[model samples]
Target: MTSVGIDFGTTNSVVAHFAAGSPAVLSSDEPPADWAGLGFDRVLPTVFGRGLDDRPIFGWQAKQRPGSLAAVKRLLRAEERAEVDGIEYSVEEIATLIFGHLKRSGAAQGVGFDQAVVTIPANSRGIARYRTKLAAGMAGVQVQALINEPTAAAMSYSMRSATEETLMVVDWGGGTLDVTILRNVEGVFMEQASKGIQKLGGLDFDSALARLVLDTVSDSDRWTQDERTGFRLDVERAKIQLSELEEVSVPLPGGQYRRITRPMYEQVIQSQVHRVREPIEQCLKDLGGSASDIDALVLVGGTCKTPLIRRFVADAVGLSPAPGIDPMTAVAEGAAVASAILGGDLDDRDFFVSTEHALGTKVLNPNVGLVFSELIPRNHKLPARATETFTPVRDFQDQLQVEVVEGDPEKPLDDDDNVVLKEWTITLPEPRAFGEISIDLTYSYDVDGILHVHGEDSLGNVVLDEAVSYGASVDKRELTRIAQRVSRTLDEDRIAGPPGPSASSLSAADRQLVNDVQAKILPFIDDAEATQLRSAVTRLEGGDASAAAELQAATRQYSYLL
Candidate 1:
């Protein structure tokens, strides 16, 4: 019955629990002796590495180690496994390792680790969120729910404040930058808008500083992998030092030292820092509010420790970050608060989340080919439902293919800015003229941020209705296997030649005969029978003189279905 809050961050992760009526961060039971000295007892570096025996290592022990991966959270959307020293470990596996460690650490603190609420970036896509849940499941920890990082921070912040005020959160972590605007209405926090910039965070700052050091090196390209890693570690240290001191000397791979001034460090990261303004501005615009409307500014993530970042955010919002909210532990603490609320420990507060992207389907337009028909617009509050009516684009089109997509409402269906989440084919009762069959597509988005689609035709016949979280029900590895199986099936088909005669290879008379029978029986036949009939037509068209009898046999068999 002890549910905790876990912030699975990009640069670092933290576990917290609600004990004695307040959220408290948990320190590792077996933490490094100097972890507290380094301000890391409550923070676990999001690093994964391999030990001498090729076993896995995580957290503090894995930092800068051989075959170690830092900022692995950024790669969750791009890849599933990472090859470390000849071993391929899946992203979920790495997350499981991290979660398992956190769970044990909580257990050591006399806290139950069986169920917990986890946090993710506000703009994390469906795949990443799904994988996070999967990882927690693999770790034997049931994820009570997934909360957005900024929303959690707001929750944590709200617990300390008794006044009703609008809050803006700027979360710049190691992987992305998220800006959220929310309001405190009668003690309930409701997110009004959120914006995110991918690949903009603390790690990018490190990379920018590393590039500056590389420019000073004589033969930077020739540095071995080990040298490069060491240099990166040194650069990150120098960057941290530069935040506190006016200047610091970064040790190079060859024992050379490069002095970096805070001014110079800020200049090197100016581009990345400046990009933060866009999300902030957009979030304000999305919520129809400006700097004066925000009563408090909340900052989350270690990256906010940079003085320049703090200054930039303050100047952009015309408000300083609220006092007493620790950037390092706010998210975890907020998650813990969420846990307490869900556990019924707190009865005075609640929160509502908003959708990050527009949800809709693709419709064919005579003028534009295919256009996005938005059902639920972006920034819509969760637990929402929207229905849109569509029809067939072509006469005699017996099946309607509805493609569920999420993205900018203004973007084209095929644009890279939009993603096709799912595709469904609704078999109609019969062929009809263009625009004759009324098909209703309803998209219901639940509070968990999962999407369910309901589709039906004019006759009240249900076509398709299912919960779709980017196919989270199917494991990614299983999806890969299924894809590979399909590919092999296609390859085998190609190698075996046409299952049916190429319409091009058929004589005019044979082509007409095959097409006539196929059109007549395809509507009544099942998929397997339809495929067989097509193959028979192909044989006839392929100049198989013997194929005429086979085609005729299929025609008679299919005729019974009609």
Candidate 2:
């Protein structure tokens, strides 16, 4: 059984595992022919797109395809489903595809694995964590446990030394910013606190730069989908280049160019960079410490590579990123180490993680309706159990409804940030007056991060006890069906020969127009119309002349929107 660790990131993903008693990141043995100028072959781009065959294409192959989905982890935070090329897929299904790629990629490097310890952002709610695990399971990858990204990075950095230091990790990735404060003592790693700002990261910087480019370039209103995609790629590249160079010229359509200086880039993203300080301040507050008390600051994430961010961290913490840590791969490396620890390979070390959010139940109050009552407060040490006693507000209450929620304890019950993980109905043995009977609600969070809740009456009669489920549970049958479909898709990808020429004689420009039209109208049109358009696009890709005519008709019908 090979112990594996997977970092399914927002912008890129990596797979690593233990090799010869040390963590090793896996990479493809042979690079693709078109790998030139793209990112390192080891890091897979988190993207999805439709191929010419109308099937999904992933990773770098999806980069050129118009309308490809990128940075989709942000979508998984709040969405249950997403549409790709007129095909609706559950968010978990999309994640399954990514995991499947990592699984195969790892195998190609002679590290075949079926299970892994996956990393997630420290601020992830119960629903997102559940979906991540569900996706991994659907991909035939058993997730042994979930670890926080910042904690994993800190562990990876700390494992190299036996220093007893207070470390703060500032993990600003593509989609989120997480800050963790902890102490590494001897071989035991204990987390003190964690705070984060969601939906604020590298992608936001890219968007801001893209806006700057569009505002400077002329005829921006007439840009097509392909041009827009090309410009987006260019903006991302220039953002990276700006990190090294003081300025770079971003090429525009029609042989034009726009110059972007580092100062301008920094100004545009200054607000986001400032938001990073909030989590750090909050974490310090939770720790009851100041920046002067920290021994070192560990910076991990591609976004942290920007010079401006480094300067900001140095100015804020009065320290540089801990020496010798690869910002891009630290989290994955840490995950591999954690995989070893969880697999019982590291008996000398005691690794402990803390709860990211407060876990409790909603209680009715006379003044504020339903309010959150904390059972296990945020940053509490894990493998923890807490019991809170409650009495019915009404006389002769027949049953107790336990609304298990997770969120900031300061938030109101109706606040959208407060997520209800599960709800339970405990039938009372007999109707009793509110003041006469009391029920004890107990919550236990295990080391594996699973939560269980139970209740009992004053008479010691067990009312309800079960593992608390987070999010809406998908039927096992549905999961199996999706898994079968995914298997068939992978099989087809393996055995299918090279693609044949299209049946239609439409020129390249005509085909692109039809694609643009389809992309333009799919959202506004009805499902029936969308289906017709999808069929036309598939036929057009297959060189169907009649289908080109059908696409032309639909294009004419929806020209108003276009």
Candidate 3:
């Protein structure tokens, strides 16, 4: 059996195998026939649908269904839930459906994979990762490891390069943007840190263009709700066209249409482009590295194929982006290379993986109040272990709370932020006195990067020996419930009504007043894009007070859409 590597992406997924000498992509029985013909041989859509019997039909077959939800990537949130034809599925189930397709595809290629490596965004949280692992388990594949996508891309790039150098891998995939700084130190790849914007990607840019098309129709009073939705779909096509052509004509209802220039599309998407840049700036700052210090800026992902994206990156990074590597398969290829290394099949070629952050407990001290004594330090090598002593504040204290936290100590304090407290309130019994120093907390990370926290007192008593897995935080089933409630709430609000009439919808006198304000604001609006101007107009026209609040939440959840 051969070891396989999978890049289970949001928009599309691919699998690869290492044979003879280099990693090669496998082929899938799906559309985009070229997916199976190129050097990166295998690629498949990640969409999956449930049948009446609750059995999932995956890949192109699932996507071919009428009204099929094609972008299952956005639905991967731990808190997202969906019901298709009265059958509910968690993000993990959908992922499993896709994985099953890959498994069958691999089997079709005459390769039975036992051990496999998977790629994920570097900044994926514990829950997202746990769900990914569960999805792999459902597919019946033994996950040899879960490597960061950019790290894998860096490794793949490093392997082809002659000189050892530090490079920044900008992985702007269909649904996510991840920026990683890596050092190829004498052939050992070491990842510094990675930052990501989950909602910033090709989809958001498409949506922005869609909105611009919708605005033109709305202005003409020719847009029905259905027509608006159709325009949204047309916008995606127009975006693809504008990417290739300087200008493209997007057809509207009644045989009428508007020509959109690349500059116009860029104007619509400028905000999203800025959103992608912000994270890269933060990632570089966090790494304490300069753009000048980076030996190269390597772009990976289908979205990176855009000329505007390439130009922006080249301008921002002070270096021309690399060429010749297939953005879509680079990460998957890098993952195969890493799998080869772990299987003891590859030589000393460096690629970076994010440092394993330690999970430790904080104890209450009489003199110090609460002090964090780390059992495992951040960036500790994987499959590693460390033990630490925790003394009770009181001599006979029977229990201690082991607050497991993951993050840099230097992060700003925010009382409302949950990221500040990654995990807390894991308790362990203290078997002896304070002077006796009764409990020992041991933290270890496995090959898959899942954490396990174990504790025992001075008497060799085990207080807790449980896996600190993602599913433990919340039931996977509840995620769908939360999502349903959230979706319903949003729909209800949308149907309730707009706050007031717009200037175009107002009386002539009122319109004049609105126009006076508009005259004052139009210059700023012209300088700003349509979306931002629309927001300002909505607020000025006394739109719902909750609009800003709702927008803020959406912005945080999908900041890439800004």
Best by TM-score: 2
lDDT of 1 by residue, 31-121 (tens): 4553334346678888888888766677767775767887877776657578766678666667766777777677667885667899989
N/CA/C clash count, model 1: 3
Ranking by TM-score: 2, 1, 3
> For residues 113-151, what per-residue lDDT tens digits would candidate 2 score against the true structure?
777899989888766776677677666577878888988
Each candidate: what lDDT? 0.76, 0.78, 0.64
Highest lDDT against the true fold, candidate: 2
- Could you tell me which 10 consecutive residues in candidate 2 have the lowest summed lDDT? 492-501
Model 3 steric clash pairs: 26-42, 187-350, 189-350, 189-351
Task: Check candidate 2 and list the clashing pairs.
Answer: 502-543, 503-542, 503-543, 504-543, 504-544
Q: How accurate is candidate 2 locally (lDDT)?
A: 0.78
- Which model, 1 or 2, shows the larger TM-score? 2
Residue by residue across 1-562, what tens digits does model 3's lDDT show? Answer: 4757899888778888878768888876455442233222346767666655546666666654543456675665444466654566566556655676687678777976645789887766444665676566545555778888888888778667857788888998878888888878887877775667766787878777877776666554655655654565566666766657899888887688888999988887776777667767866886787788889889998788778888898898999987668887888888888888888788776454553233445545688565454555544545667777777777677666556655443332221111322343434454455587667778666655566677777777777765554433544234333323333422312111113333423455444434543443333222333365356547645744444433333222111011
Q: What stretches of model 1 exceed 4 Å from their correct place?
A: 28-38, 395-399, 411-417, 424-439, 457-466, 469-473, 476-562
- What's the TM-score of every candidate structure? 0.79, 0.80, 0.71
